[model samples]
Target: MTMHNMKLKLTKVVAIVLLIVSHSVTANTGQPNILWLVIEDMSPLLPMYGDSTISTPNISQLANEGVVYNNAFSTSGVCAPSRAALATGLYPNSFGANNMRTSSNTAETGLPKYEAVPPVNTKMLSQLMREAGYYTTNNYKTDYQFKAPKTAWDENGIFAHWRNKPSNKPFFSIFNFTTTHESGLFEPYGIRKLEQRHYFSSDEKKIALLPNDHRIKTNEETTPVHIDKATRFPVPPYLPDTPTVQNDLWKVYNNLAETDKQIGAIVSALKNDGLLENTIIVFYSDHGGPMPRQKRLIYDSGLKVPLIIRFPKGYKAGTIDERLVSFVDFAPTTLAMAGISIPEYMHGHSFLDTSNERQYIYAAADRFDGFTDTIRAIRDNCYKYIRNYRPNEPYYLPVAYREKIPSMRELLRLQKDDALNKAQGQWFRKEKDDHELFNVCNDPHELSNLAYIENYKTKREEMGDALELWLADIKDDPLMKERQLIDKLWNGKTSQPTTEAPKIAVQNGKVTITSETKGAFISYRMKNDETSPHWQIYQKELPIKQGILEAIAHRPGYIESAPISLAIDAD
Candidate 1:
């Protein structure tokens, strides 16, 4: 061959080598998309958690291919406070969000309606993901004890999905399944027709029909039941072993089956888009079980939840992680998974970092509806310590909302007739002990209180001292009056404060926006109205364009500022 021909062949080989190297670099450095499947009012009751009474094939498959967390817990036993901790990476007690239903029933409590206010620099988890160039979405639930700022999500309704995001950007999407919620146990039980989406394919017709169907109520006779009524379920000692309690237990399992199907449908969509291999899938409940004592109590049945995480390429497949994880750790974990920096102000350290393993987890319980009580708990691998600030208050509070469940009514009936056994009557006691400690490893139901027992005195005192140190670290005043807490959150104001309008400046054919309100972030759209699609988070100056530029400012716990528009002329 000629010398010139040999030189051309070597040049072609070098070009091909460089091309392969460039592709590998891009694939390794790109962010992985995240999907969160958050279910409501559920515990670690599935077959994956050793409860084989009900089969959840979809969830079991996830566990087989991912890591199963044996010790995941929520910050609170209830939803609002737990969700607040998940969103902020801070404890609810640290921000005055420990109480349930802070934004409603003002007349019943004789206190003004208020929202929990976190530190000024804190941002919602989704908002932080957005600032890091991710398209964030939430499917319809934002009960974080404060109204979510407009800058939090790109799409935040029933129709929100990762499909609506730009093709080039990575996505962080959440889908909340309410099928297993506590309200589902109400009388005249029937599943909502909206859940029918789980049974059908994700075609255009199914998507279009969901929004127009206002008849959420359906016939109980026609609804599908996964568990038979005759199936005998293991009843807790605190609850009566009657048919009424068994039937409620049946409903719980059936609801979980339905939710599993819904989760399968969403996962199918991700696979169909060919993004499954590049995404991180997380499945967990907002809190725990929804029965009478389980919903609001700070026991293991209420605070412990099941967590499964499937990483890309099946990393750590079929492994079980026994580290103590809390709801406060969720925000930092997600940020870490996406290769973003975790904020220094966040109270939680990422579980992905093996060096940051926790020695203990904590939880709290406060007001439920109009009634109020103060309880705090701390747990290690084996023991749990709970302290009751209101020792004079009865253990049982008459919450009207919880009464809708048939099991709750059954408990009430047994108590009135004096037919409850000693074990079952523990919850109906007239008053509570000042301190309670339990060896959770042995008494899973927390049946025996070991605070006064001399055998466990050393362990009890050790846990008590740790709890006090935690309270001091967080600066939480759990004994403060509700009215006084509200005053502090609002800065002694009678009404909520509004964010100041954003100011826009134009110079050198570039535009910048700012707000006078401290910690307020701006959102803008170069289009028609506030209802327009995709209000972009203002992170940097943009080149001036010819259109109506609408913008608004917002800070969490404050009313959004009035929108302002700017008109730009053509050159």
Candidate 2:
């Protein structure tokens, strides 16, 4: 027999043994691999969602073989806070992660870097999967409004892929495409920041996605614009239907086509690895569109995202799920898919496991970059209620990052000249109503304010009451000063708290781990296991296994310590 054949058989045997250890592991099929295809700053603009502007063939293919979720909503209108909720299965507002971003290179906010301080023993979704022996990875976009725990993923970088893991181990991997990001609408048009936003230490990934590289078979930059400029695009009521606006819409569709090509490449990779039928593929966006009244506001245009989940062996294929799924539900749902127990601390319930359904999805908007505005929204299937705490503040805040877009510049110019009509001038209002209500089913654009409408008084009051009850339950204080919140998170200090390295003790034929830092989660990995490169959260005293053990300690907002290794003698 060939050496390669012998090695493959041994690897499969080990993988089967590992799966047997986890109680919730799939019986005959082995554990299903989970893959997340995340795109930035996009909304439901595909054929699956009733738009024919441009066809996303790859996304369409996934939809045909998967379930389409029409009512999926994000916790926030933007990425960072929404990501925080996604990572922890909790509301971003519940943990002080409601802001768009925790820290920025611009330093316009004049506040030090901070991390969303969740309650004790809170672990990220990926970290939870690692505990269940799944090889976890992220192709590097983690704008969670906090630094990810060191134990989050086995590999997290531009090159991280499922192929790099042990042949037999089931994996949970994430790949983020920035082709359709808000930055795509920037002055330079398709290449300025180029996928690396939040400007983390990703200099090594600077050359990851090359512009117009033909070597990659599905290189998005090399493709022609799928939708022509002459094509009449659907214009939202709030934005003017001018040449500049039409051009921006053209770019958005073209960018999505490029994003589809990238998605196709990833699907091809999974097929090449022979894991397509054994993995569950999820395609979704970070938030809604990047246009005005879409990216930063709490309207449905900003909060709703497109979601398609393709299950292994075509489970629930070609089905449309109208359940009100939220970003907070993502973590729990993924964990439940892996047969892991969802923690009670999680604010979201397992959509796949539980029979009960969510009646409403809540979204919030706090400070954005340097601008501070307080807005909260609650949406059911048909109605949406928005409460603006600062009624005197303009509906529009001149966010520096957004002003970089050409169409935004045109809108501002038109507003200054008073050339904008009533619909186009909605965002430029001097002040907004304290409370607003909209029947989103009838007015998807959320332009018709029904807060004072006598006919819809009952619906408006019910939504308002729901919003108030949600805020109190989550203990969300949008009125809190950013500086004060920062101080509270850091234990009255202006700087972030550091987590002390974990101390390990070997006793009674078992290993125990502890950390001095408050709220620091301790996890470890066996150095001798080639398939288990990721750290597993320490649940209880683990019996000494046949290998050397290595462990690392980390907390969000603090630097992780070097791994501490300990040699173990076989019993």
Candidate 3:
């Protein structure tokens, strides 16, 4: 026989032995299933958080049955950057993902469309879970500043769910609710028809296929009004108390209520699946509230979000955790809960182990759409320190997208008319101080800047030093130009790079796969059929296969390589 035919015969025998070993391994490893019920652009506005402006029964139930984290904060005020931190357990600034919406508005910025390239060895949190034998699913928002690698999750589409996973395998599923997003505050608001999917059964046939637009664009008359128009709203000092503002607040509460109902549906699904007791349900927002000043600023109003973690068998139920938790902590904490070892490279500490609880949290605000600004902040339990790199720049950035909200337009109109009060007009200041400090407990609105005060001098210096240390530790240059940053990320390349295709080698009756690209992750399938098959992350050399082995490679920020196939015929 030829050398190739003899090698194939030997590999076929090895494959048979390996297949038996793989099937003998237990499918269920007794790992806890993790379900993240993520919401968009919300704050602690529910009754559990001391703001009873809106009743959110579903979320309240979660709080009652879970530990409510009173001081959970996002690393960034906006969703994309904050999500990047959550996905990788690293601050967005650490990997140049701090800029909001890095993949869009290239023409306006006069820059190339770029993705945030994380450190070479950094793997997404979901990818780590998949490596630990979890069936990961995201249903399905992935605004992580970079396209997720194919090995990141088992399923990552709108229809993705724990129900789709193998019956015996544990799952790590994420369901994002966008009903409470910033666009919900737009005029002529109607409920997003797509959100009705949350109310539908998980059965694919029963789920309605809807348009991808999750924004409310129809007339207000077409939607059900959950909040009374006559209801009084507690307007913050930054926003004027006007009928227009009040109407927007009504929409906020109405949308929040809708979000609660959607949460109820998801919780019911978990219980119905007979996995409620075996699952750990975590509910949190991507960032903070969606209003103009709240959505993109680095203040408590923008960064602080509600976090509730319901452990299996009601572990620590109804307990309140006031530890300073940042978005970066999500990944490590989830890994700890899954009985998986947290990677050494992750910047976040697992909050589940309270031995090393953080005393402070850091946040950043960078470019939002076409506008660019650099602001960094650090907060402890009571005081918050804000450092504005461009003190000459006005706090009010005229972002066109934010202008869609009626309250934002109202602020501009009031500003033009010079009708705003001292407190309401603080946001429109032409210039800011180089540094500002606030006693958040005394002044929750952050209206009173105490940086120049005599009594708080010591506190100011301490916070400033802390902020500096954090920035240096993270290797973040807040003043770097976006274009220069892009070049650095691409290693001075004029165009984006693609991951090198993975190569397969057969030696000693073992199949080994590798990629030439540095830090590239390899994913492969062992099927001869030229159809879409589940891609498995290659962790080690596989027992020789006889039919076909297909593999691909991907590194964050670089384009994924095309799949290469190797066919080995049996004798």
Candidate 1 whole-model C-alpha lDDT, 0 to 1: 0.84
Please say which candidate is ahead in lDDT: 2 or 3.
3
Per-candidate local distance difference test: 0.84, 0.81, 0.85
Indicate the residue-level lDDT of 24 in model 1: 21
Q: Lowest-lDDT window of 10 residues in candidate 2?
A: 198-207
Evaluated against the true structure, the overall lDDT of model 3 is 0.85
True-structure RMSD for candidate 1:
8.5
Per-model root-mean-square deviation over C-alphas: 8.5, 8.5, 8.8
Ranking, lDDT, top scorer first: 3, 1, 2
Residue range with the least summed lDDT across 10 consecutive positions in model 1:
206-215
**Model 1 C-alpha lDDT per residue in residues 175-199, reported as the tens digit of each score:** 8888888987887676443332333
Worst 10-residue lDDT window for candidate 3 reads: 17-26
Q: Cα lDDT for residue 194, model 2?
A: 60
Candidate 3: how many backbone clashes? 0
